[model samples]
Target: MKHLFSVLCISAGSILSLSAQQTQKPILYGRNWMAITGKPLAATAGAMTFQKGGNAVDAACAMLAATCTMWDTLSWGGETQALIYNPKTKKVIAINAMGVAPTGATIEFFKSKGYNFPPEYGPLAATTPGTPGGLIYMLVNYGKLSLKQVLEPAMKMAAGYPIEAQAANSIEKGKEHINQWPYSKKVFLTHPGEKREAPEAGEIFVQKDLLATLTKMVEAESKALKQGKTRKEALMAAYDRFYKGDIAKEFVRGAQEQGGLITMKDLANWKPLQEEPLQVNYKGIDVFKLQQWTQGPVMLQALNILENFDLKGMGYNSPKYIHTLYQAMNLSFADRDFYYGDPTTMPKGPIQGLLSKDYAKERAKLIQYDKNNTNIGPGNPYPFEGKTNPYLNLLQQRGYEMDTTKRNFAPKHDLGKINTSSDDVYQERLLLGTTSIEAADKEGWVVSVTPSGGWLPACIAGETGIGMSQRMQSFVLDSALNPFNVLAPGKRPRVTLSPSMALKDGKPFLASAVQGGDTQDQNLLQFFLNVTEFGMNVQQATEAANINTNQLWLSLGGTKTEDRMPKPGQILLNNNTPSATREALQEMGYILSFGARTSGPINAIYFDWKHGSLWGGSSNHGEDYGIGW
Candidate 1:
């Protein structure tokens, strides 16, 4: 019933509310530019950059810095993966800023420690810091503003900013772990010996070490500029200092002293790569994602699988529609867990075959219309790539998927199949979150980035004020699980921070992303279908109720075999979902759990070429917000 068009804003009161559906927040319309992010303050940073005549890239970089500095579920040392639509080239470029596994990170090493995967937290779980280098790489190549301009908001926040309740609460929740690392304790615990160790809500929390680190980078850039270096060269000078100079030295020393494995060589050798992205055409629109190193392509694969079905005819959130979506997602994630990994590493997943339409049709055949397929596993995509299946023996050795009944108790009858408190610890890893950045301007530039890692409980490097990334936990320790993703030194993990882009009729159509780790692509896949197949506007699509399939190996958190295992037949749905739909899912083998908000804060922008304006959207899930003018 929501094919109604939306007029432009994020506040209440809508012109369409009288005759059509009403959304909690109104659409944000911008004639010149639009900036939407996970936090209102970060979005303000993007707006400030745009106001300074900076392009979308510059605004996005500023927001990235601000979100990291504010610790918006992420810190300055996390990974940054993005998709940029450059008006000049009229092509989408992928930025792979994900950090690589440091020295001593190997499957044998982790297994020797009596672990099935890398530890979930602490310095031992970190990779070489990637966010600072990533931010600089993006700013140098495509952004118009100087590093000083882009970092202003974040630097100010680092110096001293009023902390929000959400962040303060997170610090309190993680105080125990924060105390484990001296540097982290120094920065986060304002009242270490008191009952309330973390800062109170709205307190002017400051990070002097972080401020000094940021100032050092700025000083490096300023020195280069004064020496007659070009803007590009000056930016790279800052990048060098972070990765190869004093910053790198301090970061490596701090990490190693705290039992981390990162070496100065690892930091110096690691560099963010700018490469071509993979894409698929769905109903005439081209959807793009980063390479196999990320879980981004999973959305492209699901879109391909869903293309065979007439989604609109089944209707939105219909039982039949939900079933079909779950089935398609199931098939896609099966391949993702088994095959998706770093292409630069040996035993790389069959990237070409995985995205093939022909391959998708074959996978779709396994979807049973009547019952859930708990035994669903990876399909043979090698044949589609015109290669022999060398891992056939391994595939044959592994049979079926879920087997959690013995280790973990089932969810209560009232709660449905969604995992309950019994698996709360596991649930945290499956949904480890990140912040997203979506920026667009009238100049035809667009940037969609999903930056994560170095979350709360992170190990702060000494003097650097940088939190080491906990992304190493995303890697697999066995080839039998994911040959392409076997943990190794310098290899990137298959992360779930997926940013999205779409071009319709050879023009930029949409830029979208979400924050929930493994749920990022799943929510994004449906968010796109909401707009393209169901005709919902950007705002409505973002605010739309979505279902999450917990049928894949989680990309973050968890170390034991049982922790990484999937909860097949479990489904998470919006609380407002009709009883009939819930019953139908139960009948079809789904264990249904409900929540007021199932989505992980989807933020997006729809390029309204007809009106020559931008339409932005933020979900009702949490604190996500957007501004346009």
Candidate 2:
């Protein structure tokens, strides 16, 4: 009887443990994954291929190619960046397809033109285009399907497909820019009369030029291999066909006449930046990121800081949690401003402080109990081993609030709800919310990049596709402060495209990228918190309602800096948000910014081992859909 009792106890314990594990398992699974994008037709087609047993790479290739036809703003001539994780090799790879300034372009040239470099000058300040070369690299290296096979879906979509609501909406928002390009306008717009235009919704949009481009890409490998060239040689030959051959020469000549800077040599010398992936650890999980030239590292640094906190105890979307997040954001942005640049050019600066575990902990210490603290300072990296300055002392002083007996973890107050508007920022309070994670692996890595040109040269003026990047405008132009961000040739700009990833048990579990210019870090930080600390599923994490703090934008880059913290403590909120949340946020000392039209789409994917499947979601705000089979 004693032995039997012992056996029953042991059995009960085992059952309880298994049940706990099962509860923790993430819902949604598939060996293969599909995601819907803001661009529905493109996402739908990609989903179809996944249903046909294609991998992420194959799906990505098809989606990207198809997007050129569907999304005029995002095209083949634009840059491409991705971070990929390979489960087989337990590694991550980073790819930089960001374009560079042309050799002859000078700051003096723009100054001479009496232009102070606006935020987005597209064709006028164009750099070398990189997507075509990028596609070749992704297909030949990471993908399982042949170029032709991956491209089949894209070609079909280009030939004819009903325009999705999201795609149509995007086109409507960017219609002026689309119409600005004569070739683009001819292919996409339906300007039937003075005030009337063809409806993009449910209409068939064709891209004969893009289809021709894809056809050529497919032929290059086949024709070159027939001539006995190696794969690398054949690929290079294809690249030439893009930028140095007949199509390229015409493009260059047309662009030159329109005051564009790209030269034959710039195209010839242009090559994607390839390097090993950047990595850090969080709660025994290895977090991987791209280097600093893009803002991927910024997200990694923010996550590193949050790790020192008992974030789970803070509860989801609580006022305390959100406020603390904003504080951390301020600290991260401060570090980003002081450091974080092209490592080769800047060399051993403040960025090290940004990502150091000790520094992150110290910074985490600054979170306060009840006030909105935007003036947070930076934490030193080299201080005392095993821990950093701010967090350790702060945690000690705060008395480990995570201890259940001392405090309740749920949100204390209901601010109203989060809302949106197109005119200006509105403040509302609601609940808390959160891409696809960029994948890292043996074959190659995918990187998330936001390569924007503030000053675009006119493509219609025969500038071909050449345009200056508007990224420089992200820097503060004020001579009194932020002298480093002053516009100059070869000066990398401050950015918010925070591409980020996470690892579980030292292996890659999630990799995602985002493209919101001002909202990037805020979105990434919250999304990651949902997955790691809040214990939410990938879809839940991605779908959570998130607020944009815009630390750098508020302090340095936005249209109204002074109005960020409104007078009399009244803040604007997204009109779509609940009034109660807005009132609460205002009472708490926040000013709101609102806009119905949002920034770039946020994209993400995660692997759930418990269910033995993958889960993915795109921005609900975007017209794009998330697809998985």
Candidate 3:
């Protein structure tokens, strides 16, 4: 019997190669340390603070204080932005711990109260929270721990834990604004007798006034390390008991009982700055980000106009590599909406001619490749800095038209069936709310933060459970073509919390992040071109299938007809892509829609360096995790 049909065809080809390696989604190995967050108990409290030795900035500020007590759509009176790196000062930095505006938040005090925009939630969209002075300034400069031991796992999970189901559906969609604020309905609802709801997801969700305001800043850094002081003067006496004592007079009495404009000298002239990180390079890696008040140089000007094309011979997520990455993310978000802002009030030829490379080779000769174009704009990076396009006479005195047959639009706010852990209707339509974290170790160190504004136009400041940041609803009240994101008074607002890192030939190599809001660097530039041009691995480059560019321009803050363009042949994609690349991007004219999980989960790691190993991943789309051995 011819050797019994070659042993049953080699045992049916080893059971179809072990069922295609058990349907492919593994990639999470580790050797020394790793962490990917957006919950799973804050990536097991950053792999138990790197197995108790703590490094990658004290396991990313102990997984950002255990994701501010297991995520309530990212808070602890939100705002964090990181990058870190520092393999013994081979340097990287850029923390910024974003949060400013409120020297009495101007713009003529919300246009003399007529308020065209910038009051998304309350206390005049509060600021000055700065995630506990940017997590105690990364635990008193590159942590070793102690801010009472990296906030003892967020004060033991805010004294309780258990609340999940997407943070009990964002406290049941901010339960009517936490029943109109009685200290945000006694710390985010769950009464019992007066029958309040939301706290079900396996119950137990306590807050005990955010563990008594993180136990009064860990007993003001353990009474200044028992009067002996010195762990940087006991973390500056717990950062002057949260910005100049008594939690800055309870954030100026919850911004003067809600008609807010923060003070106590805007929480004693807030801090968290530290700079140096807007890098670029690409292919050979480098990357970094945060500066130009973030929209992070629209992924290094869309990876310098997709490095003059040929994206791995146009394949991965092909449709001519997602229409040349939607024409280099609509020409790097039309130069990030006419030159990004707040580099000290914009305009010095917008970030040296929108991060030149001969202005990205003249914006990569206006990307074409078989058309799907949308009459993109914002270029003339100030004629490569020799000046002029100073917002071209305010985009022709604000006419800034487009039309392109009304770009075939939608999303004027549907938030595509919510729950990517609450951006409460995109922060009550002021847009961009986020969450992210990434870490690495084995001493080569790495980081990638991204916490975000307090949840959906949140407020809570008084009793100190602390949930302020409506990141001043991302500024802009259009003081003439939005100066560089207008509305000042202690400036800073022009955020969309971007957090990425990379390096490769020089070390680190990838540390990604995400949480939409103008699709955070278009989902970290399609997960860094799906791991540098389709090699795919941080879990198949964040589980592949992406695409976003609803024709750029919308970094949130409104007026100019609630700006955020995207219509000229719309393009969301993502419903598990590939139906022949969605009919080749609808035969290259674009228009598609598909929705749900619109490319914003990510949370990466990578490293590898010839098998030194790390490799992590996340993106199951939402309650992401991805820990490591």
Q: Which candidate has the highest TM-score of all?
A: 1
TM-score of each: 0.94, 0.76, 0.35
Which one wins by TM-score: 2 or 3?
Answer: 2
Q: Which model is ahead, 1 or 3, in terms of TM-score?
A: 1
Candidate 1 residue 392 C-alpha distance from true site, Å? 1.1
Clashing residue pairs in all predictions, respectively, total 3, 97, 3
- What's model 1's lDDT at 451? 92
Better of 2 and 3 by lDDT: 3
In candidate 3, what are the lDDT values of residues 220-239, reduced to their tens digit? 88888888878878887878
lDDT of 1 by residue, 179-263 (tens): 9999999999998899999999899989898888888889999999999999999999999989999988999999989999999
Ordered list by lDDT, greatest first: 1, 3, 2
Residue 18's C-alpha lDDT in candidate 3?
Answer: 18
Candidate 2 stretches with Cα past 4 Å from truth are: 1-28, 48-54, 114-119, 169-181, 344-349, 377-494, 554-587, 593-602
Error of 2 at 296 (Å): 1.9
Superior by lDDT: candidate 1 or candidate 2 = 1
Clashing pairs in 3: 407-567, 407-568, 407-569
